[model samples]
Target: MTQPYVVRYVGGPLDGRVDSLPATPEVPRQVVTYVHLHAGPKIVHIYELSYAVEYGCEYVLRVEDE
Candidate 1:
């Protein structure tokens, strides 16, 4: 069994959020279908996994064109 690890999220509505997720054989490059419901229509956000020396492993929200 693989050990669980901590992953940080940046950008989007989930910015500055940390979560512990179960280990998978391969970590997906991007996480999709994150739904956020407010007073209006639900919004969907996608976060991409990134690695850096300073930030380590984190998921950054994908910026959409306006």
Candidate 2:
């Protein structure tokens, strides 16, 4: 089986070199795991990665209220 594609966030508040995960929109737990392993604990969102000219998203992380 192919490994799950790692989503990359671009533009917006998350410009670059800012390891700050905002507290507004809670990030998904699974995505958080990926981020914690890769980006760290300051990343909030993980959108689906796209290579085509037209953008597309398969699925996004959604954390249940705790």
Candidate 3:
């Protein structure tokens, strides 16, 4: 079965961090496609990521804009 991307909030002023999925290598990889902000909280800092998936072990890099 296709694995779903996982989202985990590490910690931050803006809700939290986002972690991609596969959960583990054993599962089939999946593209994040996009992060639809269902509900954006009021915060000072926030980040966004977007792109296409062409291979395995894809990553969604995140860094502070400031």
Candidate 4:
């Protein structure tokens, strides 16, 4: 199984909050993806991720930008 990626609002009113995605083995692992924002509360301060999945190993690295 491929490890999943979770997006969390790092800063703003939603800081320290996490949104999760379901995992399905039928999902193709070799595809690029896009994220669409819903029409709701707005966000401030973009968060950057320093993580990627290559090979069979998994990693989670967090480095905040100020």
lDDT score, residue 58, model 3? 32
Better of 1 and 4 by lDDT: 1
Give lDDT tens digits, candidate 2, residues 26-63.
Answer: 44333322343345556555433333333222233344
Lowest summed lDDT window (length 10), candidate 3: 42-51
lDDT of each: 0.77, 0.35, 0.42, 0.41
TM-score of 2: 0.21
Sort by TM-score, top down from the best: 1, 4, 3, 2
Q: Which stretch of 10 consecutive residues in model 1 shows the poorest summed lDDT?
A: 24-33
Off by over 4 Å in 4: 23-66
Best-fitting candidate, scored by lDDT = 1
Better of 3 and 4 by lDDT: 3
lDDT of 3 by residue, 1-66 (tens): 867664443223324444565555554433322344446853333333333344333334345569
**Which prediction has more favorable TM-score, 1 or 2?**
1
Q: Distance (Å) between predicted and true CA of 38, model 1?
A: 2.4
Q: List the residue pairs that clash in candidate 4.
A: none
lDDT of 4 by residue, 2-65 (tens): 5564544443444556555565245433322224356975433434443333322112223356
How do the residues 19-58 of candidate 1 rate in per-residue lDDT, one tens digit apiece?
Answer: 7768742745566447998999989999888875775678
